[model samples]
Target: MKILLPVDGSECALRAVDHLIAHAAWYREVPEIHLLHVHPPIPIGRVQAHVGEDTLKAYYLEESQASLLAAQQKLDAAGRFHTTHIHVGQPAEIIAKMAKDLGCDLIVMGTHGRGAVAGLVMGSVANRLLHSAPCPVMLVR
Candidate 1:
């Protein structure tokens, strides 16, 4: 099975990883896990006025990579089979698109992310994903 797990470096996100680790053996075949971290888009006008586009892009990319690396370390320590993806966009949209593009059979992610206000207003990433995902989505609270 191809599984896409999106992490935002939150305890809730890590909980999803922990759940996956504990339940990995349930699948008949070893799953190919894709650990995804989506960096929010840089505000074009503000970024251009302060920092150049290249610098903004580089900063976002660097941060995304760091998040991915952190998640990778956790997965590695758990001895799970996986790869990492760092994207720049809305978290829910990017995760769903990635699942479609990667042919993922399932998307396992957290119900609540880092931001409390945004999650309350716009709903959580897992909530959005559950409504729009192409495949089965498992939400770890």
Candidate 2:
């Protein structure tokens, strides 16, 4: 099975990674794992023109790397083989799309564990992915 793990550098997100690593043996075989970090688009319209494409790309790389670092280290320490990807867009949409494109069997991610009202007001990506992901989504708190 293929699993898509999304990391956002939050402790909650790391918890999700830990949960996956802990339960990895539940699968029949060691699953193929893919780590994804989605950078939200900068709202500045003309900022790209001022910053240049290369600079923006570098920013994305730097931020994504920071967000992915701990998760990567955890997987590495667990001796779990995996691949990493970085993208810019809405997190939920990007995550769901990546799962479909990679033909992943499951998507594992972390949740902030907000109350129902807060989740609705804040627009939880976990909640959104639950509805839109092509594959099953497992949320760890």
Candidate 3:
């Protein structure tokens, strides 16, 4: 199975990594893993114009690296290797798109476990992924 794992470097996100590590043996074979971190697009008019494309791209790379580091460390400590993907866009949309592009059977990610009202107010990525992901989504709270 190919699993798409979205990580944000938060404590809640780490729960998803832990879940994968704890339950990996349940599968018939070791799953192929893909770790994804999505960053919001750079401001096109002001920031990009001032910073230039290369600098903005560098910033995105730096931020994405910071976000993926913890997840990478956790997976490495568990002895699971994974491919890394960094995308620039809305988190929910990017995550869903990456899952399909990677031909993944499942998307495993963390949820903040916000209440429905809170989710509505906060606009949760998990809620969006649940509705839009191409494959089944497993959320670790």
Candidate 4:
């Protein structure tokens, strides 16, 4: 089984990683893990106009690397093998697409666990993923 784990370097996100590591032995064999970090695109107005394409790319790379670091360290400590991917886009859309493109059997992620009103006001990527992701989505709070 292949599992796509989307992380944003939040404490909530790391909980998802921990949840996966804790439950890994339940599977028939170790699952193939894909660690994905999506960076929100810089607005097209001033930031893009001011920064070179290569510089923007580097910025995204740097941010994604920072966001992925803790998750990677935890996985490494657990002796879990995973491949990392970085992208720049809306998180929910990027995550769903990556899960499908990678042919993932499941998506594991963490949620802020907001109430419906708060979620509606703030927007919930986990909720969006639950509805849009091609595979089953497991959310860790």
lDDT of each: 0.84, 0.88, 0.86, 0.88
Kindly list the per-residue Cα lDDT of model 4 for residues 25-72, writing each as its tens digit: 878989999999988888878887788989989999998999999999
Task: List where candidate 4 sits over 4 angstroms from the true fold.
Answer: 113-123
**Ten-residue region with minimum lDDT total, candidate 4:** 113-122
Residue-level lDDT of model 2, residues 1-141, one tens digit each, is 999999988888899999999999899989999999998888768896689888888999998899999999999999999999999998889999999999999998887522233384323888788889999988887
- Model 2: residues with Cα > 4 Å off, grouped in runs: 113-123
- lDDT tens string, model 1, 1-141? 999999888887888898998999889999999999999886687658879878887898788787667668878998886888888898889999999999999998878877444565434777778888999998887
TM-score of each: 0.90, 0.92, 0.91, 0.92
Clash counts for the predictions, in order: 0, 0, 0, 0
Weakest ten-residue segment in model 1 by summed lDDT? 115-124
lDDT of 4 at 136: 95
Q: Give model 4 RMSD, 1 decimal.
A: 2.9
Per-residue error at 117 for model 2, in Å?
A: 12
What is the Å distance of residue 108 in model 3 from its true position? Answer: 0.7
Question: In candidate 3, what residue range of length 10 has the lowest lDDT sum?
Answer: 113-122
lDDT of 3 by residue, 24-137 (tens): 998899999999988878568777557878888899999889989989999999999899999999888998889998899999888853223338433388887888999999
